[model samples]
Target: MSNIVSVFAQKCADYDEKNVQSAIDSLFAQMGGVAAVVPQNAKVFVKVNLVREMSPEKCGTTHPEVAVAVCKRLLTVTPNVTVGDSCAGMYNKGMLASVYAKCGMTAIEDRTAARLNQNFETGVADVNGKVLGKCEFTSAFLDADVVVNVTKLKTHSFTGYSGAVKNLFGLIPGMVKVEMHSRFPDLTAFCDLLCDVCEFARPKTVLNVIDAVWGMEGDGPTNGKPKFIGHLLASADPYALDAVAVSLFGDPRSMPVLQAAMKRGLLQDDLANIRFDFERWKAKRIDNFDAPPIDHTDFFGNQLAWINRLAKKHMVKRVHPDKTCRGCGKCAMHCPAKAITLVKRKAKVDQRKCIHCYCCQELCPFDAVRFRTSLLYKLARRFSGKRSKNT
Candidate 1:
């Protein structure tokens, strides 16, 4: 028999601490309280999704209210509580200060006794991972007795879904995350690395909470419109938490992160094994969730090289630099394919070199990287719209 994982959900229309506190407390209580995961005087760390230093309205980073709610409950178990995230920046006094200030993390310290993590020092853990044998992580992550992964529920361009599993990528500190994307450009390889990190941390991570109150749609993780989801989801098992979260849309197979986890035997697409009130959650399911278009895979590329290139060019969506490009050169710096370059003081992407991973699109702070579909691909989608909705 598969493990009976329990997940709970509470509708939160806003991020008000008073409104969210009771919901947070009730879900934890229903799931056996924080004591189930944290021991007395244990060091508890809350990992918030601070992808970049953006305002709360952007709905990119985990709201400060979520951190406050988690810390409020965590305090009952242990006084040594810390909340932080490894966003896309240098891990220094300047970087941490900017991210905390912009993303409202400093307020967490003021509201609760929990403090922000100041440790920039990283240590390597021998995961004996399938992809990379070793991984580098912040001391806060490795030293924490119990880690509560609080992630912003959003649509991702590459991974298809960014929930508990996608949130684990933050463990790989700083620009090194960009390096990993460059190393594993393919979604399958990249998700394997994510799963490896998730499996390594799964034992220590006590709980996973997803902030779906305001999830991003379209080009998410950074540049996307915020949609009011009104859901506060949690589970002791991160995979199960993710499994339930991804099912809100059309099909679990549409999301590569969930698909990859299923392929690795890390999780199942269905919640049959997960112990949750499926009937209650049905009422709250998002009917018209606007997820990004899925980039179809070229499985038969090996047969013919020229035909594969032609297929990719006309089929897969391409990332383009729009007028918003500030010539910051940030996109060029981290692009795995080395396809982008500054032209006439504006960033440009060489479609041929691009791999359609959307790393540049996700990492770009300016929302300058826009996705463009080929005319033939657009026509195909028009005709097949009814046949394949999520795809």
Candidate 2:
């Protein structure tokens, strides 16, 4: 615990294959070489944020070039490297085939020696988590000797920021994620659970690499605008990686997931104790970066009849599908609250039953679903802004 946390970061302007590979090799060499983490003959699982079946251009998942770069480096260590992720979709052969093909992961297998893991079996592991005792994890994730967690930097509607820790949530398959969300709906609880899962998976994760070459803002992990971050980050500690990645956007303290981890004494309060080797990368940092906007409707402290009614009418943020919806029923299928119904072709969310989890926005392949804030909510944010400044 006394040892300093090491986080390495460098700007990667684009997903140029040779450029990314060289950067990885250079970062590893600077950090005491690749042997510092992966050993020869190790069975390495290159875990990418294949959160959904999307092209790398969407900036939704890890770039194929980045995955291939890590796989190639692992190849220098061992031949048993496999790349995989269990995103928010059916984990069948047909689905996995399409996801891999669409996400440019097939290119990783084609161009490199790494195999595409299509394993759909599930297994339970004891995380010794603070929130829950154990969790259901994909066997491919649990069985691997080493898991190189390759993640994308993005903003999540649920978690304040989607970085290294939130990326590990993909380790749990699509459906289990829905169940877990149902169990822990509060932001602090959900974030605590996220920390539990990350801590559980940390032992097997030899390295955590974030693909910030191009990142996402606004509503993300599924729908958002792609912004060029021009950076690649690597670290032995996932917590440290997240700490550094979120800093580039703004104050990490404003982020709830990061705060939850720190509150649990899982991470350092500040990065002063951590060591970085980026060498003036801050000169390229985005000063006007657009972080995902937050709605503080988490205050349901009273259940009075009139109070509940008022909250029902004004406090809740509504999800509405616009004209862009292709009516694929992904929202209806994945809705944990069973609040969504496909009327004709468009997905209709029953406001009475909706939990405002924002799962629809997170998983919708098309950028169809978005938030509709109420009048009173806007007024509340205005007053809260001044209150925050005064405090």
TM-score of each: 0.92, 0.92
Report the lDDT of model 2 for residue 244: 83
Report the alpha-carbon TM-score of model 2 versus the true structure: 0.92
Instruction: For model 1, name the residue pairs that clash.
Output: none
Cα lDDT of candidate 1 equals: 0.80
Where does model 2 exceed 4 Å of error? Answer: 1-3, 277-282, 295-316, 386-391
Q: Give a tens-digit lDDT track for model 1, residues 1-391.
A: 3477888888787987788898888788887878886787889878899988799889888888888998988899899998888887566678889889999988888988999999888899997878877878888899998889999888887776788988988977977787787788777788888888888998888889999889887778788889898888998888888877876765666566666677776665565668888777677778778787666544244675664456556777788889979999888887877899999879999887887768777777788888877776666555545222353
Which residue pairs show collisions in model 2?
Answer: none
Question: Lowest-lDDT window of 10 residues in candidate 2?
Answer: 382-391
The digit string of per-residue lDDT tens for model 2 on 1-391 reads 3247889887677888888988888778867888788988998888888887899999989999999988887898799998898888566677778889989999987899999997889899888888978888988898899889999998777675788888888889888898887788667788889888988888899899999999987677688779889889999888778888887876666677777777776677765557874346466657767665553344343554564456446765689999888899998998888889988899998988777678888878787998887777666555545221101
